[model samples]
Target: MSTISLTARALLLDMDGTLVNSDAVVERVWRGWAERMGIAPERVFAIMHGRQGYSTMAELLPARPMAENRADNAVLLAQEVADTEGVVPIPGAPAFLTAIERIPHALVTSADTALADARMTAAGLRMPDVRITAESVSASKPDPEGFLKGAAELGVDPADCVVFEDSAAGIAAARAAGMRVVGVGARAASLAPTAFAPTLERVAVTATADGGVRLAVSP
Candidate 1:
């Protein structure tokens, strides 16, 4: 086990796997999509996490048109919203969010507004005032556009922000944005996060005298 401490002007967070536990919904939708696309379900699982549905569709069916990908993504979004069966907050997520109540933060997610809203609702999480959804960005994670946009909206420089992320794509996005990242899952460590924790339960937040926030993570 190890501990990490950092101070930042703002926090950029990822939605699905980071804040809300939507593994079941993600797997269910993508598995069905894989079957339809004739790709192996496990293969879809490998590339789909932390990516926009359209991006995943395009990746899975490279020869498909953008229009076709968009249409398929729309269907996936609807299915995800309608089937929020195991969605809930990740461990310690509730208190972690509550502690950061007065801090500047934004949710950067590959999910669209409808799916984001539905999953958050299913998880009993209130959306932060600032959010970047699929509709908010042209490209998805590992592209850095969403994270940079999120920092821009928060009025913080990318270098001064710390991201909390659970997916490989999200961590890569944060790094590409020039922000340090606290990887939020067991697999996160292999991605070279500034710190890795199994769950948010091990994280503690405190406000500094200069108005920045401090994070102490023990894993």
Candidate 2:
């Protein structure tokens, strides 16, 4: 496909499937929960990505109390943070991060502060200076709060920011926040992002004269 170019004043990035590959750890932890809950694994996996654990639990077990879901989520987060054996960066993530290091960017993820740190470290990726972790927002992905908060923190208008995400919830959130989205990885292709790339390897970033960013997205 021909390269598609897009411009933005700032970037909002999702951590899990976008930059870091942590599917192994996620499956290990959430699969067990799925089995214990007697819900089909496929059902759990479908809605798990890009959402906080508690949110996922609340969705799956609608009758469960929020307090219980929150408590279980804490335990799951601890388990995930302690086990980073298979966490790794997505292809071209290091170079991509380096290319945008001096520009305006922030990490907006469902992982809490500690889990985000652990996974990023395990993947050998530098955590962005500005982060909107689970703790930083009252709502999770698909809510638009985190991305909006990220734009505000970077002093960029929502319309001028581009969100990089790999899941339905994240993409929906970006769209709700009034930002264009660069969908990353296999999961994002059918979600109708503003632009789609198989990986960061297909996305190139350059600073513009207006202090924004120009992205060249390739198939």
* Global fold similarity of model 2 (TM-score): 0.98
lDDT of 1 at 180: 98
TM-scores for all predictions: 0.97, 0.98
Candidate 1 per-residue lDDT, tens place, 1-219, comes to 668899999999998778888998889888888897789998888878898888887887888899999988899899998999999998988888898889999999999998989988898987899999999998888899999999999999999999999888899899889999999876576788998888899889999887789999887
- For all predictions, the C-alpha RMSD in Å is 1.0, 0.7
lDDT at residue 123 of model 1 (Cα atoms):
89
Candidate 1 lDDT (Cα, 0 to 1) = 0.89
lDDT of 1 at 125: 84
Clashes of each: 0, 0
Best-performing candidate as measured by TM-score: 2
lDDT of candidate 2 over 56-79, digit per residue (tens): 999999999999999999999999
Question: Where does model 2 exceed 4 Å of error?
Answer: none
